[model samples]
Target: MKEILRSYKQTPASSIAARCIPITAKGVVRGRLRPITGDTLQNPAEIKLIAEWREASADWFTTRFPLSEAGTSRWLEQVWRADDRILFFVEDEECTPVGQVGILHYDPLKKQCEFDNLLRGRKGKFGNIMIYALITLGIWTIEELDVMEGFIRVVADNYRAIRMYESLGAEEIERTSLIRLEENGVTRWVPGQPGSSPPPERELATMRIKREVFLKLHQSNLPT
Candidate 1:
């Protein structure tokens, strides 16, 4: 029974160092974005929610790309171990884990960090709760950590995600081209060329949310 209970423990990502504190926007709203920590989540239901998130994530990514279950699990494990990556589980009014998000701080030379979300089983307006949490966290990180800029790379086909970033005042920086090749006898032609039957390059749209805009938004939402 002890071993089974240990297996059910909700382990926090190793990136965040401090204990998570419940934060509210003046009106004392429960289950907003909180600092990520080992003890942040105490409920077994939340752990189950996170497990569901992991399964859903594996399914989603595998359906989109050629990844094995082991590969996906390993990838998530590495992401959880990174020190510069801050991960948080977004909660609803009832404090239920609805989604997860994180900030990956890049090198100073890069002058940018990327924010992403794995929102699973979201309901109603709470669906966009991860976006709000991310934007708030970005502002806090910028002011407190003195980061220069923040950016996110979203797939061109993810229209909802693109729109959410845009709503947060993030602007498109560039569209990355991804080319995949098969080892078969035939050579694949480059994208944007006619009659070559080449594998089309995926457009990865990068958007930037500046520090000033982030601060302004956060301040506006704060209680006067």
Candidate 2:
């Protein structure tokens, strides 16, 4: 029972630090964007709501993450930290949570950041809430963080998402195989090795956008 329970339970990602940088920005679809992590999601009601979104979007997560719910939770906790990890939760004007996006492995010296999981639940229904989330985060990365460049590894099969990012001036640079592995109950992605075990692998194409180019396109009014 314990083992089974660990495999089926999922939790939301959160910041572990006492003082996290606050995020506030305007989202296209509805309201505005606010950063959320374990530290900010203390209210049980909101936490449960986030979990519900994850459950409702299980098919999405299962396909991309390919992990048990508990594994997903642990991975999320590992990703939510103070130094370089950034997780932003979107909320509407009515204060209803829409979705979340984040980045990891921010290299200040190199002035680059890798895109983390960018997911927003439309309550299991179909909507463009994700586009709004991406726009909000993309703007933040270029404008606020002052990063020179950013890259995202998206599944090659996710054409809709790829097209959306491309419309925002992201260019597909390269394609490679990425494997999802769980280490010590935490799930993470790594490049596949030769003669190693075949893991949950995907053909991921790396898309990149420069700060100047993306901001320039946005200034000219990115595809609405």
Candidate 3:
């Protein structure tokens, strides 16, 4: 939209920033979050993920995500300046790092944004669950911070993530098949192609959730 806070910028005096960013930096609380930026990308903590984590978390992110290495940095910078996007490292009770989660492209006017760059490097029993839990917190945090509605587009083939999102109260809205298209130096995943004999049946699952649903779920799970 070439619009408001296009890069996740933070107000120096923001109470939310003070309350959230420090804990995020401290890396103790689960789902602790901070805005991502190129400047912070090479922080010692992130460097550890690359030097320690088996997949070399840095490589995995660049390989799996749509952006190039530089592009990813730019994306982070943009997201940081916008201040709506959240980039987080999931932590366990003892402050062990588990994974990374993010929510970006938020539009306060429409009160929505897509979830992306959700990756988990931790292994074992709670490893997988930690990422999903972080995602849950990320979604709710976004809802409380800016958006009232949130949506995600999941590839039909990604059964695990789809199931997890459903577990988080997301309702599927569409299952239209899509095709991969490369035009004018840009690539897109879209439904069907004109005069292209109907693309393959593979598609994306559109899912949605509301603030109320997440809030009720969160409150219901909290101790009395």
Candidate 4:
């Protein structure tokens, strides 16, 4: 098992240009997001354990595909070097990595990006970390990068995740239709609307938390 610690450092404002800003919420007790690096994948046991937790709880996540050790390592490298995205490992009070989260598939032209991967500890600590992270990121994007909006896509049935986002002021913009061709050559659409074939097991719901609302949430939560 991995040990948890709180020696991790906070992300600098300048560093957000190329790295994720590590942050700690009120009840986290300890831990914060850390920059993804080669060393992050050195411990395969911890990585695999987190992946299993995510897979077993697919309903709470958007993408169901699990990353292999190699895939995971490569992903860290891309996010670390990519200016369009930021990645971080959610570390515990003991410095042990629990789960991960990131902003990917960034489109600067649209001033919009997709947020995903808000995995928490096996015991479910740090569940609200993403809320703080998103709020901070949204403020940075708007004030620094001129981004107007941030978007997140969750599994339609992932009530927990949806509730979290809505609590932070995210609003559902549209329900997307995802078509998947099964092994039996059957096409499926999500939600399985009446008169329509049942969609794939995974359905996606897109939600947006505007820059203004995000800032409001951030300010409201700050110490008086």
Q: Compare the candidates by TM-score and give the number of the best one.
A: 4
How would the candidate models be sorted by lDDT, starting from the highest? 2, 4, 1, 3
The local distance difference test score of each candidate is 0.56, 0.60, 0.55, 0.59
TM-score to true structure, per model: 0.66, 0.67, 0.65, 0.68
Per lDDT, the best of the predicted structures is 2
Residue runs of model 2 more than 4 Å from their true location after superposition: 1-29, 55-76, 123-127, 178-201, 220-224
Q: Lowest-lDDT window of 10 residues in candidate 4?
A: 1-10
Error of 3 at 50 (Å): 7.6
Per-prediction count of colliding residue pairs? Answer: 0, 4, 12, 7
Q: Residue-wise lDDT of candidate 3 within 86-107, one digit each (tens)?
A: 6655544444556656677677
Model 4, range 152-189, lDDT digits (tens) per residue?
A: 88767778878988987889988765544444533334
Question: Compared to the true structure, candidate 1 yields what TM-score?
Answer: 0.66
Give the lDDT of residue 204 in candidate 3: 74
Q: What does candidate 1's lDDT look like per residue over 139-216, in tens digits?
A: 555644566788887766678878877887789988755444544432322234333345355556879888878767
Q: Cα-based RMSD of the predictions, in order?
A: 7.9, 9.1, 6.2, 7.3
Per-residue alpha-carbon lDDT of candidate 2 for residues 1-224, written as tens digits (9 for 90 to 100): 22211221222333222222222333233554555555443455555655666666553332434444455555556654446766666655454567777777677778788776666665422255566557667766665566788898777778877888898779999987767776674455557765558654666788998888887776633333
